[model samples]
Target: MEFFNNHTKLFITAFLLFAGLTLLVCIIPALNNQSNNAPLPMAVPLSDMAIKGKGVFIANGCVGCHTQQVRNVDMDKVWGERPSIAADYADIHRTDFWRNTATLMGTERTGPDLTSIGTRQPSKEWQLPHLFNPRILIKESIMPAYPWMFEIKDKAQPGDVVVNIPEEYLGGRKGKVIAKAEALELLAYLQSLKQTKLPSASPQPAFLYGKVGEESDAKPGATKELNGGMLYTNNCQSCHQQNGEGLKGAFPPLKGSKVVTAEDPELLVNIIMNGYTGREKEGYPAMPPIGTNNRLKAEEISAIMNHERTSWGNSAKKVTVDEVKKLMEKVKVKAK
Candidate 1:
C-alpha cells in the first residue's frame, strides 16, 4: 500500500513495465523472425545501373503509385504467377546509411503491380513511349510523362538508341526522341523488378501451379473463339480500349478505324505480324508488334482481328487463320 502511494516508485515501475512490454512485443519478435536471417537468393542482385535506377524510381515518386508486392489473393493472379513472399524482397537493401528506404513494397496500387512487369511487359519499345506519355499507349492512363528523361535529336548519333515516339506525341517537334542515360537506367531498374523463381525445396503455392494440358487437344476454331476476348484484354485494350475509342492525339480510335474495316487484310496482318511506326499524321503512337512480342499464333491473330473488326461498330469480314498463317510465313521468309 505504501509503495502504491509513492508517486516516484509508481512512475518508475510503469515506465519499466511499458519498456519491457515494447521490447518483448515489438523488438524481440522482429529480431527473431526468420526473414531477418534468411539468405538472399543470388539470382536477383541489383546491378550498378539498376541500383542507380532504383534511386531514380524513389526520387520520381514511382512508389507512390506502383506496388512491388503481389498479395496472396485470386485478384493478384493477373499481376504475378504467384503471390509474393517476404523472401522475394530479401535482396533489397536500404538506399543509404542515413535513410531506411529499403524495399519499395508500396501500399497504393494506383498503377499496376510491378512485381512481374519484366515478364508482363518486357519490350523497351513499348516502355519508352509509355514513360514519355502513358496516354499514348493507355488511353485513360493518368500517369505523368517524364519527357525530361529524353531528348529530341535531329538524328540519332552512332550508338544512340532511338525511342520510337510518333511525331504527333512530340507536339510536332522535329527530330528523333532519344532516351537519355537516366531513362535507360530507370528502364533497367524496372526490368529488374521481376519475381524470382523459388527453389524446389520451397513449398509452392496452389495458385502458382497452372492447369496442365488444359489446351492440348483444343480445336483451332474453338481455341480462337475461347481466347479472343482474353487476348484482346491482355494485349490490346490498354491502348485501343474496350470501347475501342482510343485516346485523342495519342492513340487512334478503333471504333471506326479505316484499318479495321479495310477489305484487304494484308496491311493489317503485316502490321500485327511485324509492327508499325511513323503514323504521326494519324495522331497516334507507333504500334509495337503485339503478335511477335506475345507470340500469338495464326489462329490467335485471326481471333483478335475478328474481334476488333466485328465489334466497335465496324463490320468487316472475319480474318481467316489461313490468311494470317500465309502472312506470317511471308514475314518469316523476308526475315530469313
Candidate 2:
C-alpha cells in the first residue's frame, strides 16, 4: 500500500503502462506494415526537388481537394492504369519526426484524382500556367490559383523559367510571369506522382462491379471498345464542357466552330495530338496535348474526333481509324 501511494512510483508506472499500450496498438503494427509491404519493382524514390515540392503541396492544402488514390471501380479507370495497391503506398513515410503525413489517399475529391496526372498531362508548359491560374485554361475550373508561387519580372533573366500565361490572365500587369523555385519544385512533385508498372507475369487486379467486359476480350457480337461519349467525358469534357459550348474568352466554343465542322480533319487531329497555341495571341490559353500525352490509340483518337465533329449541333464528316492512325504515325515521327 505504501509503495502504491508513493507519488513518483505511481506516476512512472502509469506512464509506462500508457506507453506500452501505445507501442502495442500503434507502433508495432505500423512497423509490421512497413516491413511487410515493399514498393513495386519499377518504383523509384522521389527526387530531392520532388520532396520539397511535396512539402509545398501539403502546405497549400492540395490534399483537401485532390485525391491520390484510384479506387477499384470502372469510374476510377480514368485516373489510373489500375487500382491502387498497398505496395503503391509502401514507400510513403512520415513528413518528419514531428509530423506523420500518411499516404495522401484523401477522402473527398473536390478535384480530380492525381494518381496518374504525370502521365495524363505531362507538359510543364500546361501545368505551370494552370497552377498560376486554372481558369486561364479551363474557365469552369473551381481550383484556386497559386500566384504566390510565381514572380512577375520586367525582363526574364538568363536562367529564369518564364511562364507564358495568356496576357489577359495577368490582371493587366506589365511583366512576364516567371516560375519561382517553389512552383518548379511543386511541378516536379506533381510530375513524380506516376503509377509504376506492375510485373508482367503478375495478374492485375480486376476492378470489381464494373462493366464485366470493359477490358476483357470482346464478345462475338458486343463492342467492348470504349465509345466516343466515354472518351470525351474522360478527356475533353473538362475543358470543352458537356454541351461543347466552351466558355467565352477562354476556350473557343466547339459548338459551331469551323474547325469542328470542317470537312478536313487534319487541323483538328493535330490540335488533339500535339496541342493548340495558335490562338494564344487572341488571349485563349494553349490547349494541352491530350492524345499524345494520354497515349490514346488510333481507334480512341478517331472516336474522340468523331464525337467532337458531330456533337453540339455541328454536323461534320466522321474520321476513320486508319486515317487518324496514319496521321498519328506522322505526328509521332515528327515529334522525334
Candidate 3:
C-alpha cells in the first residue's frame, strides 16, 4: 500500500518497462533486419567527396524539392529505369548518433525525381551552370540559386574550376565565376545518384497501370518515328530558348546560325555527334556531347537536327535517319 503512493518509484518502474519493450520489440529486430539486408551487387559505395557532398545536399534542403525514390508506377518510369527496391537503400548508414536521416527518400516532389539523374543528365557543364543559377539554364525555373557556392575572381588561379556565368547574372561583378569546393562536392553527390541495376535472375517490379499492348515489335536497328519538338524541349530547350534565340554571351543562337543553315549538313551532324569546342574561344562554354551521352538513336538525332533546321525562321534540308546513322558509325570509328 505504501509502494503505490511512491510516485518517483512508480515512474521509474514504468520507464524501465517501456525501455525494455522498446529494446526487445523494436531495436533488436531492426538491428537483425539491417544485418540481413545487404546492398545490391551493382551498388557503388559513395566516394569520400560524395559523402561530404551528401552532407551539403542535406544542408541545402534539396530533399524538400527533389525526391530520391522512384515509385512503382507508369508515370515514375521516366525517373528511373526500374522501380526502387529495399536493397537499393540497404547500405545507407546513419548520419550521426543524433540524426537518423539515413534514407533520403523524400516525399512530395516539388522538382523532378533524382533517382537516376546521374544517368539522365550526367553533363557537368550543364549541372554546374544549373546550380549557379537555374534561370541561366531554365528561364522559368522557380528554384532559387546558390551563388554562395561559387566565387568571382579577376583571374583563375591554378587548379581553379571556372564556371561560365551569363553576363547579366554576374550582378555587374567583373571576373570569372569559380565553383567553390561546396558546389563541386554538391555536384559530385548529384552525379552519384545512379540507380543500381538488378541481377538477371532477380527481375525488378514492372511499372503498374501502363497502357496495355503498347509494347513495340520493331527490329533493334529499324528506323522509328521520334518527336523532334518534344526531344528539343527535353534536351536543348534549356540552353536554347523555345524561340531559338540563345542567351547572348552564353549559349550561341541557332536562329540564324550558319552551321544550322549550311548546305553541307556533315559539319552540323559532326558537331551534334561530337560536341563543339570552337565556340568556347568565343566566351561561350563548350557544348556537352549530348548525342553520345544520351545514346540517341539515328531517328532521334535526325528529328532534333530537322527541328532545329526548319523552325525559328531557318529553312534547311531535312536530314534522314540513314544519313545520321551512317554518320554516327563513321564518327564512332573516327574517334577510335
Candidate 4:
C-alpha cells in the first residue's frame, strides 16, 4: 500500500505493467504467428531505381493520400483479387538504417488503394499525365499535380520519353512535356506496389457477408442482358471518359471512332486482347490491354464492344460472345 501511494513507485509499476502487457498481447503473439514463419511468396527487394523513387514518393507526401493495404472486406474486392495477408508485407524492410521511412502502409485513403496498382494500372501513359495533372485524366480528381517532376522541351531528343498532354489542359504552355528521371523513378516505385499472392493451398477469400445467396435471385433459363454501362465503368472508364469521349491527344475518343463502329470487329478485338500503340504517331499513348490485365471473359468483351459501338449516338452492330471468342482464338494462334 505504501509503495502504491508513492509517485515514483507507482510510475515504475505502471510502466512495467504496460510493457508486460504489450509483450504478451502484441510481441509474443506476433512471434508465435505461423505467418511470420512462412517465407515471402512474391516479395522482392526494391531495385535501385525503385528505392530512389520510394524516396520521391515519401518526399512528396504521397502517403497522405494513398493506402497500401487492402482490408478483408467485400468492398475492397475491386482493388485486389484477394485479401492481404501477413506474408504480403513480411519481406518489407526499412529504406535505410538512418531513416525509419520503411513500409508506407498508409492509414488514410484519400486516393485509391495501391496494393495491386502495378497490375491494375500498369500503363506508363496514364500514370505520367496523371502525375503531372490529375484533372487532365480525371476531371473530378482532387489530386495535386507534381509538375516539378517533368520538364518542357521544344523537341524531344533520342532516348527521351515524351508525355502526351492534351492541348486544352496544357494551360497555354508550349513545347512537349517530358517526365524527368525523378518522375520515372517514382513510376517504377508505384509499379512495384503490388501485393504478393498467397499460396494456392491456403487462400483467404474476401469477406462478402451480404452477397451470400444473392446469385439465386436470377431466374433459371432467363438470360439477363449484360449492363454495358456498368461494365465500362468498372473496366474502361478510368482511361476513357464516361461519355466515351476519351482525353484528346492522350486517349483517342471512342464516341465517333471508326474502330468502335467498324463492320469487322477483328481490329478492335485484337487491340483489346493484345493492346495497341500504332496511334502514337497521332499523339495517342499506347493503350494497355485491359482485357488481358483484368482477365476479362469473351462475354465481358462482347458487352464492352457492344457498349462502345452503340453508345454516344453510334449504332453499330452488337458483338456476340461467340464472335469475341473466335477472335481471341485467332489472336492466340497468331501468337503461336
- Scored by TM-score, the top model is 4
Models sorted by lDDT, best on top: 3, 2, 4, 1
For model 2, residues 93-186, the per-residue Cα lDDT tens digits are 8889999885788989999999988877666766887899997666778999999999999999999988877778888998978999999999
Ranked by TM-score, the better of candidates 2 and 3 is 3
Decreasing TM-score order of the candidates: 4, 3, 2, 1
Query: What's the residue-level lDDT of 46 in candidate 2?
Result: 91
In model 4, the clashing pairs are none
- The true-structure Cα RMSD of candidate 2 reads 5.5
Q: Would you give me the overall lDDT of model 4?
A: 0.83
Which stretch of 10 consecutive residues in model 3 shows the poorest summed lDDT? 213-222
Instruction: Give candidate 3's root-mean-square deviation (CA, Å).
Output: 4.9
Model 1's number of clashes is 0
Predicted candidate 3 versus true structure: per-residue lDDT over 1-336, tens digit per residue: 777799999889999999999999999999898888899988999999989999999999999999999899888876877889888899999999999988889987988889888877665777888999998888888898999999999999999988877788988999989999999998999899998888889876898988775437667766567889998887778887788998776688999999988887877777777777887788776776677655567888899999999999999999898888888888877767
Error of 1 at 153 (Å): 2.3
Q: Would you list the clashing residue pairs of candidate 3? A: none
Best by lDDT: 3
**CA deviation > 4 Å runs, candidate 2:** 1-14, 211-233, 237-303, 311-315, 320-336
TM-score of each: 0.65, 0.73, 0.76, 0.82
RMSD of each: 7.4, 5.5, 4.9, 3.4
Residue-level lDDT for 3 in candidate 2: 73
Candidates 2 and 4 compared by lDDT, better number: 2
